[model samples]
Target: MEQPHFKSWPDVAPTLIAVAAGRAPADTVIRGGQWVNVHTREILPDHDIAIAQGRVAFVGPDASHCIGEGTEIIEADGRFMIPGLCDGHMHIESGMLTPAEFARAVIPHGTTSMFTDPHEIANVLGLDGVRMMHDEALMQPVNIFTQMPSCAPSAPGLETTGYEITPDDVAEAMTWPGIIGLGEMMNFPGVIHADPKMLAEIAATQRAGKTVGGHYASPDLGPDFAAYVAGGPADDHEGTCEADAIARVRQGMRSMMRLGSAWYDVETQITAVTEKGLDPRNFILCTDDSHSGTLVNDGHMNRVLRHAISCGCDPLIALQMATINTATHFGLEREIGSITPGRRADIILTSNLTDLPIEHVIARGKTVAMDGKVMVDCPHLDWPDHARRTVNLGPARRAEDFVITAPEGANRVTANVIGVVENQAPTKALTADLDVIDGAVAGDADKDICQIALVERHLGTGKTVNGFVSGFGYTGDMAIASSVAHDSHHMIVVGTSRDDMAKAANRLGEVGGGITVFKDGQEIAMVELPIAGLMSDSPVSEVAAKAQDMVDAMAACGCHLNNAYMQHSLLALVVIPELRISDLGLVDVTKFELTDVIKGSA
Candidate 1:
């Protein structure tokens, strides 16, 4: 079914004016609620909101004049009425669900608007994939704006994607409906060094009068950062410290502090607002990459808001950061992010401000969710079979395919290992001494080191780049493989035994695409993400259940890093520092170049 198209303020001004003047009765009246006015940053008690033609007609001390016999009355009972929450930056595919399923999952959590980047699918299927995501987003009950993906390989020359997004692609996408802006420019160095393609994409977005999303992953706050800020991106979410937040805000860029499944970056950077006296309006709350389990069990933007409050932010201020501040960043404040006249009647009814219990949610003057349940259907797209079958790991992989051959005569070798940092996106570059067994480097389980391989899944190359990773705490003959590897969407297989690694890789291929875990030659757990090998077509509840089981299986194998699955998928991400594996080889992201895994052999 087609969702209602949002009417412009001019188109609905007549009806809204009629209802406000009591010349015509309103369609709905929410009475006896405290208006949490974000514009004034104060709560006004005993206000009545009148809605007409899916837009807020009036919000004042009383709406009795606008009410008639046919008007539907909802008694707010003195509850706090705030604008529906908005996520400034997120990737819907990260939730392991389609756009429709993601909206269905978060509507009950009070998130009525989202600015999402479909770059995950773009890496797998290119421009066609982005169009599919945009088409589905337009059919949702709540706001789901699509940002044309800016970086597919994330960093050209550093990584390879199944499809490359060109400047022409960005220009064409800007003309499409629902294209809010260009997605996060993950190639910080490219923008800093003035790469022609990156600049052209930003130029296209600016020419279209759209915001450009930023992702400066580097820790440097020097001239390079200054150059990047001058390149025209408006926001940054890769900040992990107070200094990072302060630097971005000082440069006139909004600092987006994310609290996703594995990235706990809010507590560290929110201090820029809590203690450092930085302007809170310059900060926003978002979930850059949340798993389905986090959305179902914890919350969406609500989770990030609560975390901000716990870190010493005022509840009202936090709400503004999640609502108006976000909408203003995308130039959408007049259309959303407020409980004012001439705005979409997207409001949430909650009893407490601090805890933020979403008792009821109304979107576009219609009650869409009540008592943690969705009242409307989130329409789905008919994804073709070719999109579902994306895991093309040419020719069956074998144990020999994952073997890391040592140098000609080395008995002991110091190898560069990608050290996974818990609750962060950046990895630590560490060195490990491993014994060479029959001219092959072996993983030392006692030392918490495991073999990580990047199997090229996009093209039928059948090439596997092997390296070592630490911090998963795995200590058995277990292996985990996923087609949800970030940026490039290659297959990442980490395991102790080569046999188990091969089994896990083949299992994902056989299942079309998904995450799978194997132990002692037996499949322990799996979650099939048949859509582009990055998301499932199932309901969020079903996906969350399977994800929980996958987490349990990882724990059973002695892997105890919080949300280790996220870490595993990012092992192949070549954009973030300091060490990562890609289809090319071991990459030292800090240097933005592929380096040898064996320290002294190459």
Candidate 2:
């Protein structure tokens, strides 16, 4: 089938006239609506949008000329017509669905574009996984652009990835039709120090004239920050404070404030524009890692927009942050950000400007969603068998695997614990005194402390690093297991009882790869993430429903950390601050070094 393209308003004027005159040949024409022009931040009333052949042709006061028989005329009832939202930064695997399914989940939320990085999957399944995600994204009805993962191991020496992405990979991927730029370069220390590999990758992305993503996740806004700015990253989304946001924009970087499933960074950072009086154009909205629950139950980019507005930002500025600003950041301003000529006819009709109630959504000039229901088919990809079967436990993990042996004849000891922050991406480094039993240290659930272990699943190494975590508040005989551990994508299991931990890990292995909760030696909830142990082939709503059960299971165990699954996945990520676990060992992320959980600090 030959796809249609639009050039100018004049070319679509006749079709618009036909639609208004009840003689249009277009697929759909929305009439008598107020257009919320995100480009100029204006709401122009009495506008009509003419969509035909899956691309918008005319948007004007009247579309009575291009109308012919069989044209669908939609009366907007004087509502607000706005551009469909765009996510400036995200990860598809974090949603635990393939790109096609992810698109299907967010279409009803009025998200017409997404800039995703498949680096998490790349770390688990390599470049082949990136290709798989990219191909499926192109098949979606809405825009799903990819950023070639810049950091595979994320922190090179901190941990090992299943696959490594080189400078050559970035250069080669630049020619792919759907690749927008380089993914978030998580190696901030490497970039500041001018590491050869990181510099080479940045050079390749620059040579291709694509934007380079940044991640300077530190509180130090000193010389190191300057060094990172000189390293050529165009934008950063790790800012969590007003100072962080102000510094990034001052250093010629776009300040990307994100509102993910667990990351509530928008409110804290949007003050850079709302109070500090910075240029709003340099700010962007992104959902760095939103799970399917947030997408199906809450919203996607629309959620971010609402959060930005609630943080005292102007409604128009919030809309721009989710629209034209994001499009310009990725160099897609001419393609999908605005309602101007030559762009994809992706737009939304809403009832309220501040609340932004999405009533109708049009993608590429075709009405794809109406009243929160998808009206089209979102295609799926045939995932290979290798992606489904990834959990490799070299041997059975015994209770001894989780026992932290004390020094010599030491009876009890003080240990550094990784404290999970609720509904936030950052963790707190905490210390606690524990009682030793039978020459091994055990978790004190009364103090809200539990055992956390990271089992290396990449090469059947069978290496397990044992540690303790607080703030989960888990009591009794319950354990949680997940293969979505971040960065290296290893399996992380936390429990007060060693037997339950082993059972949970074993069940995931039995199901190929998934999350399982066990209490009293019985399974309570499970979600099969058969694709690279990070995503599922099932519909997002189904996965989301199961995810709710997993949440309930955690709560039933007497744990009360908000969105603790997010905290669970990040336990293995060595990039974020305070303390973390990895295949290598427990990492003191602030110092970027391996430290023992019990004593022997530094």
Candidate 3:
């Protein structure tokens, strides 16, 4: 893997000293800006920042002494000079775009730093996919650090991933140039229970002197949370409430409040710092998973910043949460977090702090974006043919393949259902009473209950597990299926009609890997994610347009939930939930065991 931070402080220390002392001319200078100093939580007007060798050399009231004819001077025009926004945690694959395309989409939005977990690809293509993502991320002008994915199946026996990450893989990835830490330890139960495999991965990361990311999804902040924290994870982005945030920060973990496409967690959690008067340094801002449409239409980290500010956080404090707090947590504070001397020149010029308008962005002392247009190249790696052909359905599925059989002779059954929670990651484990027709369970469209299945796309096993779901409010003989199922990367199909479900799953298999929506057995809209069956290498604009169409198609089917596609894709995420479907069966995540979809007679 290639290194993104090319200029070490030692490499430019002499030049920096010279420029600071006015002994040499600066390479670039941003003059007459109101510096939003995150270090002191203050905004100072009439400041100038001088850059040399892609690193800031001087930040003071005047840099005219270091100016020369060759020096490129940018007038900030009394704008707020904030550090380039940083996403403390995110997944590039969730956007249905590769690292290069994700970079292209977010650069103009003023996101210069990202801490990305590539577990979506890891579950599909393993270490090779992770290395590919890391390599492409380094090619971009901004800072995109890769966290070696710690879990593949996520919950060990609850689900089976296409590729499992091993302890040796974790250790090996730590030595890579771009890897900042171990990815979110999704198996919090494994940590609490002292699972050998989970401990070994955590030990390897610690031995390599890197951070261990965390995901404690349970609402319990008691003994389980303490045990998981003791297992060596450093930060958590799964916090959704004030208590969750406070409990995390109190235990020395940075509470990463996020606002993703479907996850609206920041407003609920930011109160730990704003209202509770806790130290804001331990609070971080992130987009845990923003899809292509969210990235192109709404901003990236800037969106989180504006939301945090709207939630009553001070603007400077919110910037700190998105920038320095993130960099400091990952031990990159000295390199790329701020505009201080000897740091990477990743700065943003905005006309205002509230409702930040990214007028211009500079990453590594160069003008990478201006007025919502990327001016630099975001490069792509040559993905192999095998990565494109990962979806292996074994054989075409039939409508009969998705039927949920009721217990023998039972006319009615109480079925466990996965309930979609709007604007959140966790789903409610609900149960519904439904009728059994021809010994098969039937979904009640009026009750908003529908059939859900996990199609085993890896290993060509021709296996599937059927279940039920609710809260999407879908109707009119529609089905939506995605190969981008969380953690396992299996194909999750949900629909009112078994035939339409079959059609949607077959459509993805026919295209190798992608998301497709079907109504009355006809394909309505689709987004082809041919890479690892999770993301596409296409330009973000094209993918976003197609994703919007998919959203529209879902709406046409009478389904309405904010980013329902995201909720649909996570139907099989066995790690973080109350109930989920896996290749084996319907998993009761609270118990971490497979339960029959059909219970006793209703």
TM-scores for all predictions: 0.99, 0.95, 0.99
TM-score of 1: 0.99
Badly placed stretches (over 4 Å) of model 3 are none
RMSD of each: 1.2, 2.9, 1.0
- 433-486 per-residue lDDT for model 1 (tens digits): 998999899988888999999988988788998999999998879999999999
How much is 505 displaced in model 2, in angstroms?
A: 1.0
Cα error of candidate 1 at position 563, Å: 1.1
Off by over 4 Å in 2: 1-27, 600-602
1-602 in candidate 3: lDDT tens per residue? 55555667887899999998999999999999999888998899999999999989999999998898899999999999999989989999999999999999999999999999999999999999898898989888888999999999798888888889999999999998889999999999999999999999999999988899999999999999999999999999998889999999999999999899999999998988888999999999999999999999998999989999999999889999998999899998899778899899999999989989999999999999999999998888899998899999998899999888888889998988889999888889898899999999999988999888899998988997888899999888989999999989999998999999999999999998889999987999999999988989888999999999999999999888899988888888888878888998988889899998877899
lDDT per residue (tens digit) for residues 300-388 in model 2: 99989998998999998899999999999988887778776556779888898788787898888878899999998887888999988
lDDT value for model 3: 0.92
Which whole-number lDDT from 0 to 100 does residue 350 have in model 2?
88
Residue-level error in angstroms, candidate 1, position 381: 0.6
User: In model 1, which regions exceed 4 Å deviation?
Assistant: 1-5
* Global lDDT of each candidate: 0.93, 0.87, 0.92
